[model samples]
Target: MKRSIATLFILFSITIVKAQEIDSLSFIKSKRMSDDDLAKKREGTFFTGIPDFSSDPVTGFGFGLRTNTYWNGNRDNPLFPYTPYLAKLKANAAYYTSNARELVLSLDVPYYKGTRWRFKIDFKAQQNPANLYFGLTESTLGQLRLPSDENTTFSTYREFDRARKTLRPGGVGEADFVTDALSNRFRETEYMLNLKADYALGNGKWRIMGGYEIQHLSYTTFEGMEAEAIDPITGQNTTAPNGISLLRRDFEDGLISGVDGGWVSIIQTALIFDTRDFEPDPTKGYYFEIANEYSSKYIGSQFDFNKLFIQGRAYQKLPIGKRTVLAGRFGAGNIFGNNAPFFEFQDQWSPEGSINALGGRQSLRGYRANRFLARSMWFTNVELRVRLAETQIGKQRFAFAVAPFFDAGTVRDRWQDLNFKNIKTSYGGGLRIAWNQSTILSFDYGHSKEDRLFYFGIGQAF
Candidate 1:
């Protein structure tokens, strides 16, 4: 662990390159263009320079800086802790050129013209840790995205619960009802800082990309996350009364169990390869990517967790005598060493108790939230998309279209210790639009067999 952290630190301090020039993006001028016509125009470039670097879409490589601000909602509110406003920025440059050498080396993205190899130095800073993309512990993890509910297991719930308990308020033992809720707490403020780099091999048809990720996070949960009520140094439980507390409805049902102190460290190495010469295009927008990610804390496992993920994403444009497109992705995670939190229900008077639990956004969407859960959990997600309007309606900024999508995944508890076969699934879809190819508007309708959900956001599904 010490060696890994040292390597990352050395890599981060080693390079500073220039930014590459980026060409403009082009698209079909009409909603009526035939599929073949759209495919023929693939020669247009997003990279006008050797190594691509643009602050716009955040594509190429170079020495750049990025800042992300995530403003969640007020913590004193109710069930939901965040309102969701986010913006990310970066400054970077890169260069790439080919020589008649035995091995290829260029900082350019291998798929485009004049593009070679590309490398970048990136510094990310945020006063609020919750704004970070990933963290080691549950609380530090911030606005986490779990696998689909249909795929989650009881163990997943338990691991989640364990993490939540670290942040409970009201000192130690709170109300049964409130303790249960606090055990599944959410928080608002967090600050973070990160430094990393990206390296890509440009071969036109095949390319390999990988990099290092390091971050420091300070976060807070809606529920307090400390075990003792008083400060060990000052002799006081500094977080109480003002934070979320685990209170009882009557004292039989569990409310919250514990609160946590949100601080963690994460360091990872990533590697990915793209085949079939994938390029982003409106007409021939087809590509497939398969990647494996392994993450661990550079420091010891103070939070107790480790993760291994095998996932894949694919995109394709359909040609059924129409200029339509379809894109989707599927992913699953097998976690070990990490303790997910759940609930430990107490019966009327039986010392301690455990019945069963289920239901959350990660899976079982049709069921009420936290409806059922157990020991271990597994989850998966898949999305289907369509392109409605790609060409200009009248003015360049008037382009728009509609699409219906479907999403499904599940979670589980413990089924012979097999996470793959235990969870369930749900499906749904939505609509999208683009203005001058710069700004995109999206609305999606996601549903399970028994529940329907709507999501509003920006950009393409990819």
Candidate 2:
């Protein structure tokens, strides 16, 4: 990709030429503290563990182990000036390279012991296996091109030329690998489990959330995906079953609904209104939410639905520098019953979080991650952020920032098919680190109209 974008623009111009030789001598208490007194003399427990080697265009190389623990309890309590730690923990366990696999655990205790509620918990388990199915509505965006003529079938133009190819398809002017080969027909296989919770409503900037989710799906189409054709009147070759897979032709034309595997079960709720002065990395405030979900069969859900979402976010500080900021987000969602289980219409919810929307890395960042599905959807994201340098090591406190982003969205299948038509955008840049001000480590890259991702996550991407 142009030598990985010229080696990430020469490592972002050597991090802006070593940001003043790494903040000169790493600022010795800058004339005696006051980054809020060096964050109140660095309160308490703080741990971080790394080694999570990454790469992603949806799960490529993502090795394992990631950890974070922060406590910050008493700077004379009282939620120590509005919280950013008073308890936080995260754990991750990756395993990508297409066979995808993940395990995560999280916890946050906002205003908790200091009153006005605020608590959270999250757990996840995933299994992927190439998961991805480009069909659900909006004509799956005209099947993402590449079938101009060929009356369709060479395993659907080599699986849409392995998702929009770029050479390497048997080389030279590609597209000629007949006999149904790489056809998982848009792939399929997923296993999931999610658990969530949140509570705080009485001036902890309103909150109330709940959750329990489940998923189990599988589909393969037909062993090695047959394809032979030419039997109009039995004069020769025969085999084709429409060469299978669009999740087995939407489960044999029923237009999807648990294709051969089951377990859906869900229940969730939300109503939030955070004022983000710092929910890890906010610079200013205003966050809003409204979520709802349910799946019955009397809650052991084998399918039956209800969903709703609404979101908003904002942050601002940009008066030109000294740590500029400007953030934005917007959302919308829908899915009212009548059998919800086409992977639950590509998720979207909030209580402060939930995603999988118009596309990847937290919504449209260079697409491809649940790349659009339907039943209703909407999205937006904007960014600015700036802060070039800061340092300190012993008590750990580092800072560096730069963001530049934009994203857009669209989707539908109902909810009267909304009508923002097509949409789908991306543009980006990012880099942030601020370890001991409460862990953040992003890295973004974006750029879409069909992909150009690069993300290393931790937070922000709100």
Candidate that scores best on TM-score: 1
TM-score of candidate 1 versus the correct structure, residues matched by position: 0.48
* TM-score per model over all chains: 0.48, 0.30
lDDT of 1: 0.32
What does candidate 1's lDDT look like per residue over 88-177, in tens digits? 122323321210011111122211222323343344342321111111222211222221121333333334333333223333344322
* Poorest stretch of ten by lDDT in candidate 1: 345-354
Candidate 2 whole-model C-alpha lDDT, 0 to 1: 0.65
lDDT of each: 0.32, 0.65
Runs of candidate 1 with Cα error greater than 4 angstroms are 1-115, 119-183, 193-202, 218-263, 275-305, 338-384, 390-398, 412-422
lDDT by residue for model 2 over 1-462, one digit each (tens)?
Answer: 312322343354344334423212212111122254335446777788777876777667788888988887767754565666778788889887766778888887765665444566776666665656667776665445432232433223235544322211222223333222233334455555666655443334555555677766655544234444343344455443323344665666687776666676766656667776667787777788767766677757577777778888998887786778899998888877555667677667665566886677888888777767888888889999898988887767778898989988888787776767778778889888877766778888898756578888777778
